[model samples]
Target: MKQELRKQFGDEFQYEIALNGNEALEVVDELVEAGVNVILILSDWLMPGLKGDEFLILIHAKYPNIRSILITGHVDESAAERVKREAGTYAVFSKPWDSTKLMEAVRICCNKN
Candidate 1:
């Protein structure tokens, strides 16, 4: 997935990978220290530790400017609403996402004119 994203985004964007939410937090910290401003996070809902929505909420609390997208195969309506209302996510995509739509969301959320 990272490779695919890297191929799509190329060297224009910095990408970070983590095994779990905790590691993701650490990576975010490292990026901040390294003077890299995070623009977005694309995460799976069934992550190892914290769920995607929960993780995004956590990140939003600290860095409200950062945008988020949740990609999951299973999502309840109420959970989706909660994440949207609470996390301020850019959008939610089902599994086997459409690359064009995903990129469109990214552009809309991160670079709206």
Candidate 2:
């Protein structure tokens, strides 16, 4: 996915990766401290430590401006709905998502930011 993102976006945007929710939070804090204007997040619903929905909600509470897109291989409809309603997730994509649609969504979200 990272490779795909790099291929699509090139150097237009800076990309960061974290292994788990805790690491992702730390990375976000570091980026914020460095004055990085984080505009979007793409997270999987099933993660090691913190679930993606939970993580997105926490992030939304702290940084409402940061748009999120949730990707999941297996998640209940209610959980997806909860993320959209509570976290204001921009979109949710299942595994094996269409790259074109994902890229389009990212472009729209970035443009809005």
Candidate 3:
């Protein structure tokens, strides 16, 4: 996924990947330290540490301006609704996502932010 994003964005955007929530938080700190405004997070639901929904909510609490998109292969309807209501994510795309749609959503999100 990281490689695909890099190819799609090239040098136009900065990309960072973390294995878990704590590492992701550290990356956020580093980006802030460098004066980068993180506009979006594309996350998956099932992770080793914090679940993706939980992780996104954590970030959102700290940085409400940063939009989020959840990409997951496994989640129930109730969970999806919870993300929409609580996390306030921009969108939730399932596995085997359409690349064009994802990019379009990203473009809209960036423009809005």
Which candidate tops lDDT? 2
Candidate with best TM-score: 2
Better of 1 and 3 by TM-score: 1
- Tell me how many clashing residue pairs each candidate has: 0, 0, 0
* Clashing residue pairs, backbone N/CA/C < 3 A, model 3: none
Estimate, for each residue in 11-106, the C-alpha lDDT of model 3 and write its tens digit.
777889998877887898789789998988888888888888888888888888888888889856777777777888888888888888888788
Per-residue accuracy of model 1 over 1-113 as CA lDDT, tens digit each = 67776766677777788878888888887888888989988888888989888888998898888888888899667767777889898788988899888888876776832
Which residue window of length 10 is worst by lDDT in model 2?
Answer: 104-113
Arranged by TM-score with the best first, the candidates are: 2, 1, 3
Q: Name the regions of candidate 1 deviating beyond 4 angstroms.
A: none
Q: Whose lDDT is higher: candidate 2's or candidate 3's? A: 2
Off by over 4 Å in 2: none
Instruction: Give the per-residue lDDT of model 2 (tens digit) for 1-113.
Output: 78888887888889999888888989998998899999999999889999999999999999899999999999589999999999999899998899989988888888932
Model 1, residue 6: C-alpha shift (Å): 2.5
The TM-scores, one per candidate, come to 0.90, 0.95, 0.89
RMSD of each: 1.6, 1.5, 1.9
